[model samples]
Target: MALSARELWRILEPVHGMIYFVPEAQERFAALGLDRMAGYFASRAAALGPVSGEVVVATFYNFNPVIVHAAVPAAWSVTTPAALVEARYEAVGAALRRGLGELADDVSELAGLVRGAAERACEVPQGRPLFAAHAALAWPEDPLLVLWHGQTLLREFRGDGHVAALLLEGLSGIEALVVHAASGEVSAEALRRSRGWSEAEWADAVEGLRSRGVLDAEGGLSEAGLAVRARVEGLTDSAAEVAYAGLGEGERERFVELARPLSRAVVASGMLPFAKR
Candidate 1:
């Protein structure tokens, strides 16, 4: 059977996501005077070229704007966007090299496949602000970095579509996190803390979801909420499918086959702390 876009994401996400959790990346960011949250906001948003916190709030679409405001603009003062970008690439490369070891030497083929899809995503950059910004950056020379950059672009492309999907359901950023927590995949406390949403803000979003019949009395997803979640994920996956249009089914399967073990190696190396979450 052909792999779906969501399945592909599941397989490839670890490769790119490791950068956020690895100590190497954090150390690099710290050297630049960016704390953990500030590093995250600044490094990820660096491709947008020192954009304001408001732009990060809009494009990121999950974090509390207050946290974003605390990071960006201020972060730009500590380190230029270009410097952050270079630091992130260096960090990701170091992390991948340490995590992948021997597998790093054999990533050219996988990188080529993922880069093809990422380039395809770049061609239709309308409405995908984050993806477009990353796409505007020059491609990395190393195959491992290429693979990482490709997955980053694809992740942002899917993320932009997901924001649109959430909006279609009239879900605010906090509300979307609430509904996701209600699905039991992640705890509400974790989401709230990670996104820097206060308890009051979370309660308001929960109350709003309950009033809309998306959550039941116990704060779990109601049938309607499940349907809404399904629709949002479906829309996201459908939108992401466009990136794979250039790949034949055989090639897509090949990419997954090759990428799975590498991603698993990254996961097994314990570089991706969120994988435990």
Candidate 2:
């Protein structure tokens, strides 16, 4: 069977996502005088070279600007972007080393495979600001970190596409979260709280989506809403297909084969208990 872009992302996402939930990241960021929220904003945005919170808000696309503003630019005052980047790398390496154990030794081939796709994606950086920023960074020598970085690049590339898809569907950031929450994968409360949106703001978004027929009376996706969601996801997948242009079908399958176990290990390590799709 041919691997779809969504399947490929499902296989590799865990490896890239574990960094957000790992304790090592928090510890390392704390050492640099950053708390959890500040650390998250700083570490992820560091690749962009000490940009303002507005830039982060524009690129990140979901978080409340107040939350972003509270962390960024201020984060630059406490530590340099170079240092934050190093800290995140150190944290990812430590967490993966501890989590993957012996599997960490055999990541060279997987790293190469993922890097090929990531570099290919880098070639078309026209609108992928976050991915472009990470792509400009120096590649790490360690295979495990290489795998992590490569997956991070692809994740951001796909994320940028997702944002574009949402915009094409005429959904605002909060409305996007509302649609996602209605999908039953994640709760509206969790999305609202995590993004720093108040209940009233969330309720207003829900009402807006409801008025647009994207949500039914029960707050779940109606038929039109489901179609809209499907279109957005399909468009996102289409956009991400460019990353795998250089990989033959067999190589793509092999990439998934090689990555599945590592991603499973990352999931089983209990380091990503809070991670959601």
Candidate 3:
């Protein structure tokens, strides 16, 4: 379902706790340039449906279900943050529209300025500067920061120092496990296999998430665990803001230039190196 004006606003917001989440996203978008990704974000925004409390909840969950669960109930304060992000965009978009009205002959430069401004505003670099304006127009201040912050948390994927997190972090050695704990598929198995552990070791890893309620008997994401997973999924846009915040005025342009090139490198370089490898 498409988000109503209010629902859209809820998904977009200003937030204090998010930067340093998933940073690769910002770099990727910048390097790809604005045109490549704007349509995607716009589509995502459109697909999100009306921003009810549940929709808002899922927004955070999609980032990294675990993050949302860990921060549970605390992360639901949507109204205030949403309002702030929306308002800022509205004011800016209105100004830009007026300037566009007067400068028909200056369309190219005007568009460039608008694009640059939106890029900076969304903290997302170039790929879809207009998406930010659309976000601003669609939902006001909420668009700039909330989605950005929520997505970052998910991709950064932190585990609790508690049982499940600690075990999964290692995923290499353990004994006790339920029979159904063997469905990680390649990615999950890769997590265990790459660790170079035996079957018994992988079983133990499954049990850990199970015991902590992070995984079900079959090792799929449980409801609570899913929430955390959601929190991190939409990490790209959120991290862009942090990248922007860190850039400062002096480094901003340089940062954008680097993002454009480095993002291409991430793909060209192939799969990222495994920290364990």
Candidate 4:
């Protein structure tokens, strides 16, 4: 069977979100005296080679622009480049350490599996700028940590590509969230509040999408909406393929096979919120 977009996401999303849910990572960030650091890490990581906050906001289209702006202050004032990069590496190292410790019995096997995915993922070109920058960094001494970084690289690569696809499809940040809500990935109210968009702004976005045939009066996806979403996903998969270039059908299947168990472990560890549909 061909490697589908949904399967690739299944293999990658857990690895991406695991860092945020890991206690070791949270503790490390707290120790460093950081507040709301997700945007900070994303901005710093995507700099590739010294980019500005404006650039980051423009590229990271799905997030609340305010979130990006909030990160800018910390990125410029609270930390030096060397220090930030060190914190990133150390925090990831610590999280993986704790995580592996928790999964002690399966450490060796998990390491080999994650390492193989990383190796295969590395064979693809780093198509997204953020992914390219992260990929350019030195690999960690521990094989597991290296795999974590590799997974992160792939995740961000696809994220950047997704943003590009959204823009190409003419969806605004709020509109994108509205479409997501329409598809039941999340609730529109929750997304609006979380993204800090005003009720009026959210309503306007919903109206825009409805007018565009991407959403119906009830704020659910219309058939046209589904097609649009599918196109965006298709573009994302195509863009992400550069990273899996060397992996053939068999290799891709094997890579997913290796990563599945680790993905399950990550979910079981309570590092990701699994939405039961």
Clashes of each: 0, 0, 47, 1
Query: Each candidate: what lDDT?
Result: 0.92, 0.92, 0.32, 0.66
Flag regions of model 2 displaced more than 4 Å.
275-277
Candidate 2 lDDT over residue span 1-277, tens digit each: 6788788877989889888889999999999999999999999999999899999998999998889999989999999999999999999999999989999999999899999999999899998899899999999999999999999999999999999999999998989999999999998888899899999989999999999999999999999999999999999999999998888889988998899888888888988886532
User: Which segments of candidate 4 are over 4 A away from where they belong?
Assistant: 37-51, 100-127, 274-277
Report lDDT (Cα) of residue 235, candidate 4: 94
What residue pairs clash in candidate 2, if any at all?
A: none
As a whole number from 0 to 100, the lDDT of residue 192 in candidate 3 is: 38
What's the best-to-worst order under lDDT?
2, 1, 4, 3
**Candidate 3 or 4, higher TM-score?**
4
| Prediction 1 TM-score vs. true | 0.97
lDDT tens digits, residue span 129-148, model 1: 99899999999898889999
Q: Worst ten-residue run, lDDT, model 1?
A: 268-277
- What does candidate 4's lDDT look like per residue over 1-277, in tens digits? 6786457656746755766556665565555566645534543543354455576666656567776666654555544555556666676666555544554344344445444554555555444666566667776666666666667766766787888899899888888898888888787787887667888988888888888888877888999999999998899888766656655687667667766666666666666654231
Q: Model 1 residue 191 lDDT?
A: 95
